[model samples]
Target: MSNKATHASGASSDGAELRRRNVPGESNGSAVPTQAEVDNKKSHKPKSQSSILSTLDEYEFLIAPLIFTFLAFFTRMYKIGLSDIVTWDEAHFGKFGSHYIKREFYFDVHPPLGKMLVGLSGVLAGYNGSFEFKSGEKYPEELNYTFMRLFNSAFGAVCVPLAYYTARELNFRRPAVWLVTLMVLFENSYATISRFILLDSMLLCFTFTTVLCWARFHRLRHESFSVEWFTWLFLTGISIGCVCSVKWVGMFGTALVGFYTIEDLWNKFGDLKMPKVELASHVSARVVGLIIIPVLVYMFTFWVHFLVLENSGPGDAQMSSLFQANLRGTEVGKDSPLEIAYGSRATLKNMGYGGGLLHSHVQTYPEGSQQQQVTCYHHKDANNDWFFYPNRNKPLYNPEEPIEYVGDKDIIRLIHSQTGRNLHSHTVSAPVTKADYEVSSYGNTTVGDEKDHWTVEVVNDAASNDWTKIRTLTTSFRLKHTSLGCYLRAGNVNLPQWGFKQIEVTCVKENKPRDVYTHWNVESHWNERLPASDPGSYKSPFLRDFVHLNVAMMTSNNALVPDPDKQDDLASHFWQWPILNVGLRMCGWDDHIVKYFLLGNPIVYWGSTASLAGFFVLIGWYLVRWQRGYQELKPIEIDQIHYGGIYPVVGWFLHYLPFVAMARVTYVHHYYPALYFAILTMGFMLDWVTRPLARTHKTIEWAIYGVLYVVVISLFILFRAIVFGMEGDNKQWRHLRWFEKWRITD
Candidate 1:
């Protein structure tokens, strides 16, 4: 046959085959179908079914996330209000919220945004801020704590969908994305911490948001400087600020973003095709979105904090004398004598950057002479009051006598006004700083001892270089122990619970004249014989006050160390966290009271840890295979490994490794952020392991995934009691304990 005849014969045979198969709209061997036949063929399907499948195909990306988010919220809000009593750190954060509602300025180590949100929740729920929020305290009927809990729960619940979208942004397959969402949604620890007025939920929420936004931004690098790129970058910055505002731990998340940006910019810098102007634009955009915006947002939170808290509260003493003066109810440097005089009653403040007032109480030390405890107290109280009496060399300080100005080289006896005892230091070892002598209050007003004597040596006068009389709130002075020649010091060494967690007072034998801890100044002075100084002279600028308060906050935060004398059952090491060696008791172990334990699901945590290990192993195996002239992964797979696998590992390291070097007390909750990255890594591993199986052995791949889903869901059910609240005897529920170190039942 000719070439044209051959082509026509093939087409006729194809049409005959189509008609025999009875394909839709192609019956009776018709080569062309009319519009009526086409419409009839489409109408053979049910209207609702066709419409539903079309809608599913159109919005398929949103279906899984929406379902996961609803389930997440349901789980988190299920029994959030079960406990009417305060649990764990609610004692601290809840009280902070109350302080905000009452407009009472209180000092805490953490930033104010988290507590501000808590206070906002309280305000919305109509809480009066009258409740003390003591640990394990029962909530009043009108407290509406449930609403506050629900508000916090909302943040944690949203984290599930954020994880899902973040996985999708990382190019995870649908099954892997579902796994990531399921891990976060069912994680017992995350859910448990979210059910209270604490900051962890907010912190986690912002952290997840930052990571998700960063992933989106990274994916849009191909569309650099596009509106979508800029939007994600800006959102990442805002999320960074918010996360950090909740707690300093958020800096770890910030560091993750920072590392990714630096690497990205460095890669772009090496590209020869990139013009200098484009590079500059990239640099400027990152600087604005990552650095400037976050800083502005952080500072704005503080501005709001300062604007709201105008009245003096318990935290007034933590601030500088001048800053305290600015508070409405504070009497700092107000109507107080400017110059120190004999028989003057005053509070001696340590002149260090974050020092406390010299205070003594009637409670005796457990060891070291067993005398009345003298410590550095950060709060104002009557115990801080002291009488500056003249030494034995001078006549007994009397109100009837003429006003005697206390000058340099004057020997004085500091009498604890509350205890009628002198500030005494002896050769006995200090409670914490054993190298120094113990400082204590000893001897009644009628008795006398040389140890009680201290030389008042003025270091310098703030108002004048040439001044004989000591000045209040300005003169930097030292109290040299007359007998031991040691200087009275408060070096931020915190004491045990017996000492009320106050800074330890010590008599340092090393006479370092430049030691700020040894420096002392009169904070609150009272002398009926002297005239009040000018209040206008004590005006502290806002910027100076702001810096001073932040430094003070950091100093106090660093001082939170474990007491060597006692065992902190609540404390855990960083290594113990990953292995699930311990769990925290969120409330009392009372039989009637509802209890919550902060613990991760064993299956989820263990699998995440394994996934982290598996990442390194797989990467090593691939490198070795490539070096041996065999390639296991293609270019696309390599890119996936770099962006999805390596990036999450970096994030995990950034969030986790810092804890190893930290001197502060750490707990399992500290590991939650790192746990999130680990979860991502786990999702990546899941996808990597099942990728080939999904293409070839589809049944086996689905079976493995099915097993995982079942195991994860089953474990969540088993661990639900820990998050939802367990009551009655813990011994009865001991079967839930999976590890020897897990003290969950107890």
Candidate 2:
């Protein structure tokens, strides 16, 4: 028969006929199948139904996940109670836990649910005390940082199993499961951060659980909605709520889940022939059970503690109930005064409400403070009134020309007739030499003011008057006030006679012969006068005020300049090593979200980048290869295997990219335990993508395997650079240096 006819008949054949043809063993009177027969049958069968439990025996299949889970557990639990000292935010969280245990419903930036969980752990650790939310006092010294960290570590341990379940839901093969589990085991940040008394590990655990539940929900949709499905959905919701309680960023998971539900609803109802109302009700029921129930579960998990806590007053309890009810009711207002007040009060109380902490105490400068200052070198009397001169200082006056001014020691005046603009009355000091004139304007000019602009004019060696402009006044500018002082303009409009060393006019005045000084000298004098100990001196205030300002300005200027040399220094000094510094620069010194980004959470940034890149690649690969072997690959067989199903392939790629990318950004101090879960998830995805291709084309299978090898090598190099090159000074340059090291290795 022809190949096409053979393929058609092969498709029509029963499993028994296929097995008989494929199996090597003789079927005689109740004899067991031979190993070779089983092997041959398995090889011919599609991979979708080929479980490791059947191929390697159940024992071997079970051992790997168990071993991986144990390793993950050990890594998390080994340093569980070792670090005695609390790091930066640990102290605040510890106090919050104490407060929660004492039943103090004190407001905090984070929801109270996470702290309540920590409080439960604290109680277990023998920290029975009255919680003082403000001073953070009454914390049990016996609990220690290690004990506090243990709770998160244990949660981190739970993540491995959660990851496995998630992978299994996606029908990942044994190899993919193992690869993901192994990747999670070695992820440094997830490991390190999990061992600290912070919310990140807990956040990660909850996020993994949510994803797992979501995946299960997706897989089990073909069956009628059962208690098991509801259970997973509920758990997923609880995890999301728990995450939100720990940090607001947890809401992202909730958003993702909601999106998934909408997609599910669309798929279920889009082609239905039922009435509009019936269809709507059906979709609504699914949404309520899957999406709404989980959200409520999450919210209720947080509300339970608030309701039960003794310190949570009746009003607080009412408010908590109201908030939960609002979420259920879909009353998502754009802004909530209560939430704003709660956040503001919590931050203020935590930081100590002294000095400028109070809103009323914040400094309020006058409106003109926004405008630049303009200083003129005109005469000032004892009362500091302008000295006016009536036409004595003409524009074309010679050095020996006699000048007259109508003025007393108490009052002075000046008149100028250039450009028809009058210097009718002004304060004039003694005659300032060219050098002195330059000094007076130094640093005194506002950024765009011409009087402050300085330029060096090159005069010809032969002629005193023949001078050429060496450089334009693009940045620096200098002015030479002659015997007759010139009227200074604030803008960059040039004086007609002031170019190329042409000394035209000089202003001589009759005030005390004061030494002209540069702005630097004035600043120096201010510094000296204050002597570093004087509280009222300008230097101290200027230093304190201008540091942030200057840093911001320099960073902005550096970005615009595009000088790679400057960028190299800036990146080295401020942008790369301490990822937080880069976040700060990105945020323009805003401490809210930028601070969180810097805390070594790679999923938010790097993971996102990797996911996007991986997604495009997968899409491209699928578009190219999906129909290439249509003649050889039967649709029925494809359905049975479905290893290369589009959904599974996408899921696997997304699942692993986050893990690998996050590992590349992990730091010693902050661990994201979810990376392990991510890796496991990706492995399953890869297995799905590879198995289909493998059955059809060995070359494609090997190509996929080669890609994985390259990915692993690249990840190894990246992790090495992050681990070895970073100096952990929380500066931008260090981060750049770390990046540089990675680039060099690459």
Candidate 3:
């Protein structure tokens, strides 16, 4: 009975297989399809006439990026060489690039990677670094200015396609990607800044690439640990380092990535199905890829920076005495004594980062003590030289007296070598810092009072503190007024014009032991009794040099605040940038000279800002609906809400909001990075509003897109002259200026 039941089931299965295949089985058990099956398949296949269109549709991503990149290149490259003269920031950055070509070390508030690239461009173009690069001066006829400008423009042109790819990675629709690309390609300010040899274009390019790589990495979260996943994670890390190496503003992009990674890890931690080992692997991967990789890449850029710039230049004075001593062609510490003695004639440098040499001039202070002016001067001159002498109660400093090395807790008097006056302090209030006592040079070397006495207190010794003797450039000490008990300090405050606008020297009543402003070190010692120090002893460690340079950069950046005494017509407020309320003239305003304006295309700028506001409104509306128990969002919709809406919003905030607290002078170009994020938000909002219409009302969606494209294109064309460089009278651009605040013309 069992055998008969099995036979029946086998026969039924064979009948069902035959019916499904509609063909006969061969001896090898492979089905032989009938001619009709072949015919049916052929009928469904695409014809040769439509095959090309199908292939194009399949590779829309590649084709679209290529098209946008070509357009971006055209816009950025058009007439890039028209301005043969050094424009606004070109005067500064071009000189920096020359320093690199000459192998001369220089200082700047920004990082070195961008300027290094600029120098590379100049080197490739056979530039000799002969031109002074003065503002508004014409370039040398033999110089290859066009090639340098073209190199920088390449970075700006690539930004358009980077925005396109970033949008595609965010799952934006085709039209939205086009919108973002067009906005970046046609923006006037971006194009203008790229046409000159400046750092802004490189900064924008790296920033855009960073966001693109980050978006790609975020999408691979579900496939963690896969080859493609790890590839994107590493790329994102590299992009972060490159962006930061260009400018510190790149920190904003890094912060955006950090915020996302934290949220992602936190979410994964809550998943009950995930194994403990897997979670640990995820955390480890992020630490290696995001933290370690970026740090290494950032350090590599600085290493290259130090390697290429080996010779000392104008920036030598800005660095510590020990750091400068390591540079070739520097006179610092050459033929100078190692230890400072009572009769040593030396230049004292404030230990604070970005501080200057202790200086005094013959000019008397207009206020307070009306004594010879004592200030911190960045430049070196005879005025900076001072002679160390004994206190008034003790015998005067004698070169013959058994070489008495200046030691800790020793009473001394400092006399100006040129002015023949004693470094003096009094109870009068300081000129700038009212709470502090006044510091001035008073009394001659031959005649002085007790007010000139100062007690030396050693703060730190680079080698060892066992020896009480002070060493030049290695020991930091403080000068305490013997009578007033105030510490002699030189803060960042600038004195009035009467005092040569140098840093204010004052005596602080409170004793802050760690205050770097109060710390001083002998930089250039000239004592005949003491022997010269070993040159090898001045070698600065890389880590210490790196940290010290960064602190100096920060100090210099902070000193860029707007001056109350003068008005800067080119500077703009942070709020004015979003609204397009002002613009800057990039060169000479003469009627004959070519002029360029740093202003955005109004339609793109205004539209993107409005989209930012609309995003917040949409979020509020959704929260209200959800609170009332309406859960209408699908899985895809939720994903779009986060990646397209929340991500770019956070990026916009990170880049723009920090400027609100910045005390430095800002310009219109400062807003371009944040503008990139706003453009993304605009694209998302446009897709959000137009997507539903495409399914239900096709004609209305097409009409809306047509209007948008026309408006964006028309506005770009109207203000195109401003970017390409305008000439003739100011009235010629009157029609282009919609707002009075726009300085497109005089």
lDDT of 3 by residue, 307-334 (tens): 8889988887777777777788877777
Name the best candidate (by TM-score).
Answer: 3
Q: Choose 1 or 2, whichever is better by TM-score.
A: 1
TM-scores of the models, in the order given: 0.82, 0.48, 0.90
lDDT of 2 by residue, 403-518 (tens): 33211111111111111111221222212232222212111111122222221212111111322211110111112232234322221111122121111121223222221111
Candidate 1 lDDT, tens digit per residue, 1-746?
43222222222222223112111122212334568975786699788876887677446567778999898888889888888998999999989999999988899999989999999999999998999999889999999999999998899999999998888777676677778888999998998988888999999999999999998787677778778789999999999999998999999999989999999899999999999999999999999999999988888888888888888898888776656666787777778988888889999888776789999998999987999999998878899999988777667777897888888888899999988999999999999999999999999765878888999888976567865888877778999999899999999888888999899999999989989789888888899889998542755566756776777889988877776877988899999988788889888888898888889987789999999999999988988989999976655467678888999999999999999998989888999999999999999998887776755676887788788888888988998889899978888779988776777775
Off by over 4 Å in 3: 1-46, 463-466, 509-512, 529-537
| Model 2, C-alpha of 237: deviation from truth (Å) | 3.3
Q: After superposition, how far is residue 480 of candidate 2 from its true place, in Å?
A: 57
The TM-score between candidate 3 and the true structure equals 0.90
In order, how many clashes per candidate? 0, 43, 0
**Native-vs-model 3 lDDT?**
0.84
State each model's CA lDDT, in order: 0.84, 0.39, 0.84
